[model samples]
Target: MSTEAVTVPPVRTPTSRGSDFAELSRRIKAAGLLERQPRYYLLRATALGGVTAATVAAFVMLGNSWWQLVVAVVLAALSGQLALIAHDLAHRQIFRTRRPSQACGLVVGNLLLGMSYGWWMDKHTRHHANPNHEELDPDVAPDIIVWSQRQARSSRGIARRLAPLQGYLFLPLLTFEGLNLHASAVRAVARPGLKQRRIEAVLLVGHAAVYISALLLVLSPAKALAFAVVHKALWGGYLGAIFAPNHKGMPTLTGNDRPDFLRRQVLTSRNVTGGRVVDVALGGLNHQIEHHLFPSMATPALRQARPIVKDYCREVGVDYAEASLVSSYAQALRHLHHVGAPLRDAA
Candidate 1:
């Protein structure tokens, strides 16, 4: 048959179903989980805080030697884990009111992790508002790395060269992510216009003083430097590994394609399915779809909320993507590779 005369299949537009957000909200409310369970979260916060403090104390008390590197690495992991607690606090998941939650966020974010709660909230709120929207979502905004096909293909010079190999370089690049976050947080606080900027900056400065003083006082200069490097890099890599799988492989939206809240969050988020071990490690982020839907829910509650959200999605014809840890990573890698293919071909 001639090409012009042949019939071609028409593209099927996704049916515009009415918003399920209100329904999901009702289900979640009926589940009676939106209320902050102070006991559970407070206990979790205390345990994480105590463990992180003890680890730091151990690091300071220990001698400056090869073993200090191991301590530094451990401390970094703890700090990364502590960040998860800070994340929940920032979302007001543990507290009924904003002030107490903000207080907890300051303690965990500034004192414990040496990061800025204000800066994180400024960025993270936008992410929740627009999870995968290219312009609106800070998570997918242009960074040191290119994450989309358009970005990769349009990149120039050195970035263009690196775009093609991003998937392979993803982990190695993540090793530097800890330092990147620190710099970004510092920069954010350094700028004017943020609420209570001076106080936040002071907290950050205090953290820097204490952190550096303890390390330098307890260890030789070379050892201290080594410790800092190892700790920060490991913390970055650990966090990257856990978080990248949540939405990196999922759909990316443009500003105009505004889906309703429930559909937007569920379609863009991917869940990592394992057991409680993975759950704990990811700080309940493994159930990303559920967590995005019910961000204020306590971490433990996310797992409980998963079935409800999944069942709702199935009934509503919404996509709920989930996979094992390894599988999710593979999917993300494939996505990266696909996005960067044009750059690879050009090179």
Candidate 2:
């Protein structure tokens, strides 16, 4: 067997057929789960928000100084979950129009993750548009590690070294406003066409005012710090893990080329868990494959939509890739090992 003869495996990992996709997509579309029931979204948002707020409140109330650390960690996890909700609402067209989504996403995104809704939506939209295409994907900024195999094999490679820094250290620590935050910030300042700077100013200033007021008016810095720390650790780590797993390992290519949207998203991204839990907690992240297929669909709707799409894919015999969080992480590490400029004709 020649080295050239060792064929790379097809991207799909889960064995799905056309029937699965048909039922999932058709069922999802038929369900008319557009823009999720507002009550559902509101209830979910409130519940998650309460859980997060309560956790921090306890830390401050209990007077356990170190509980601040615990609070921060818990907040981080909760923040990640909350952010997912905002993410769903941002994309879910169930809202009367983009305005409502903007309103909701802005308020929710800031409170949950301290990121600008519009900024995130713009970058994310591009990420979806380009997938692994190196040229067009605006989300593939300098701070992010590009994926490629040749880069992995190179000794003491710059790209490989950066992966650990970005994936593990900076990513988990910084949350949304990590080093990449500056690039977007700079972009917003330079272009200012997308309302990025103004939006960011609001978030930052708003955060400062609230935090300062808390410290001055009510909770002490110690208490506030406790909440902030825990929230950052858990939510930051969770968000980094979810986002990094999908694209890190799959494949990298040039702008001239493109992957079939369904095919590439399926290959590059993997669904973590499934069912309503995902639809709710993960904000359709569980329906990651579906969301990639039709990002315009609201995330909450992905739940009903997943089965529809799954059935459709099954009937079509498209191999689907589904991984447990643990498996996904293992693959993410491997994916990080490869990142480079895609050569032309290297599909």
Q: Which candidate is the best by lDDT?
A: 1
TM-score of each: 0.92, 0.74
Q: Assess candidate 2 and give its lDDT.
A: 0.57
Off by over 4 Å in 1: 1-18
Where does the lowest 10-residue lDDT sum fall in candidate 2? Answer: 1-10
Q: Write the per-residue lDDT of candidate 2 for residues 1-347, one digit (tens) a residue.
A: 11111122343443453433344454566677544476766776678868967985775585645545665666666767767766666666447577777777767665435566677788788888767555566644433354444433342455445544433444444364432443454455446566646765677557557755654454467666555545555565677665765555555555444434555565555677644554454555666777787776765566666666666666545656677666766766644432332321132
lDDT of 1 at 11: 21
Please, what is the whole-model Cα lDDT of each candidate in the order they appear?
Answer: 0.81, 0.57
TM-score computed on alpha carbons, candidate 1: 0.92
How many pairs of residues collide in model 2?
55
What is the TM-score of candidate 2?
0.74
For residue 257, model 1's alpha carbon misses the true position, in angstroms, by 0.8
lDDT of 1: 0.81
Q: State each candidate's clash count.
A: 0, 55
Expressed as tens digits, the lDDT of each residue in 79-101 for candidate 1 is 87889988988888877688988
